[model samples]
Target chain A: MSDAEDVMIVLDESECWVLLRSHSLGRLAASAAGVIDIFPLNYYADGSTILMRTTPGTKLVEMTIHSDVAFEIDDFTDEEAVSVVVKGTAEWLDTRSAIEEADRAPLVSWLPTLKYVYVRITPTSVTGRRFVRGPEPERD
Target chain B: MSDAEDVMIVLDESECWVLLRSHSLGRLAASAAGVIDIFPLNYYADGSTILMRTTPGTKLVEMTIHSDVAFEIDDFTDEEAVSVVVKGTAEWLDTRSAIEEADRAPLVSWLPTLKYVYVRITPTSVTGRRFVRGPEPERD
Candidate 1:
């Protein structure tokens, strides 16, 4: 179903608009795709990127097998909340230096080691949504 | 790399644990997930069982396709923050009485015309991490 309302509320209002603006396209947040090792990454608006360390032989290693990925980061508050979502293509880091520069060295989460190296996400589009609490506009 | 050091320092101790304990499962400090009919539904815990509301339409429809999905709720104090990840199975609810009891139906984030429906999530595992402020963590 192509109902915009069903999946994501992509309206032209400031709330949704703010969300799209919050996406750090070149940065990535870690989330489960396979095991904790196969953590997700993202792109930043400035073309730079960010991500926590990922390990080889991890689920992340398997997930980046030339596929598209979705990355999300969000925050919520009483008056307002914002979320950023990015869709992009991903590939593994080819050189060890590139991986080190990205700060994605061998690391651990819950366990002591991971399997995957680095995942480079080339973003296609990034968007966000926000909900602001209190007050309504005066009707003209 | 199953190393615990590989973990990212997500939310501090308090916020991360709070979301894990909150009875609401969905709404709390950080409301997340895709929206419905212009309404922001915070699907929590995991998509295996979602705890959000929708009047009707594709919001409810699209999620039914796969019982598996991801739900994250995040919070922060100053520059430090953490995100909770729940990965598991999702189930759709189809009951009038049950729908009326949804969290978003009435006074909480309510809309008069909107309908209330429930998505239940049963998480297989819930994990979290965030960054610690400072130059870095000193090794133990």
Candidate 2:
């Protein structure tokens, strides 16, 4: 069990996610040096949601097996940036509708080699923050 | 719950981790947005063992809140890069002996602004991958 204080941190509005940061292409990155072969991916906005596509041997197929996964998307430069995380359940959508949506993403042109493998991240919990980097001068 | 048929990728003798290519410097590069907010961090070394430290406001702290977390770290350039991810049931280190071992990590000098908080990370399930964005193709 976690302490009440820790729970509060988990609930922090700055950076607590349910899925991961692979929802969009703002600054998408992922890795799994430890467990479950984590994939932290990101793509650009197309319409109401984010989209991602990988080749046949890619791990995106496995990510679709579970409905509950973590998704995170963020963009930061210097001091200010947006970090959005979504912890939710995902349902595999191999239907024609999902594939069409994946092909329409802006990032599709950016990386044209990938195939369609769309996984919608439904945010169970969403939180984020903004950092000012340097503190304002304190009154002396 | 994950299915047993999860497309598992085997690591060769030379491939220790599945890393991503990042340019953000140290661990910041592998983050979703190169920001300090919003992290689904997972810390894992091997099975049943935790690969994290006890630090305040760090990735491990957030993971140990009884909530499973995902961790990704990376380094990158135009041609080559590496990233790693970990997901698990984050645990904490409240004892002195555990803290001693964690403090001996080689990368501890990267950050200097951690205190008051101890260590924690949920390294229950693990995953990772590597990418080489160069001309010819690189091995993983």
**Best DockQ among the predictions, by candidate number:** 1
What would the per-residue lDDT of candidate 1 be over residues B34-105, giving only the tens digit for each residue?
Answer: 221112344432222446544556444454334444555544444444556655555566666655555433
Tens digit per residue, CA lDDT, model 2, A54-84 = 5555555564444345555544456444455
Clashes of 1: 49
**Which stretches in model 2 have alpha-carbon errors above 4 Å?**
A1-37, A57-59, A75-82, A109-115, A133-140, B1-70, B76-81, B87-90, B100-115, B120-128, B134-140
Off by over 4 Å in 1: A1-45, A48-53, A96-116, A134-140, B1-18, B21-50, B78-83, B103-113, B127-134, B137-140
lDDT of 2: 0.41
lDDT of 1 by residue, A98-126 (tens): 76666533322222333335566665556
How does model 2 score on DockQ?
A: 0.11
Model 2: docking quality category: incorrect
Model 1: lDDT to the true structure: 0.44
List the global CA lDDT of all models: 0.44, 0.41
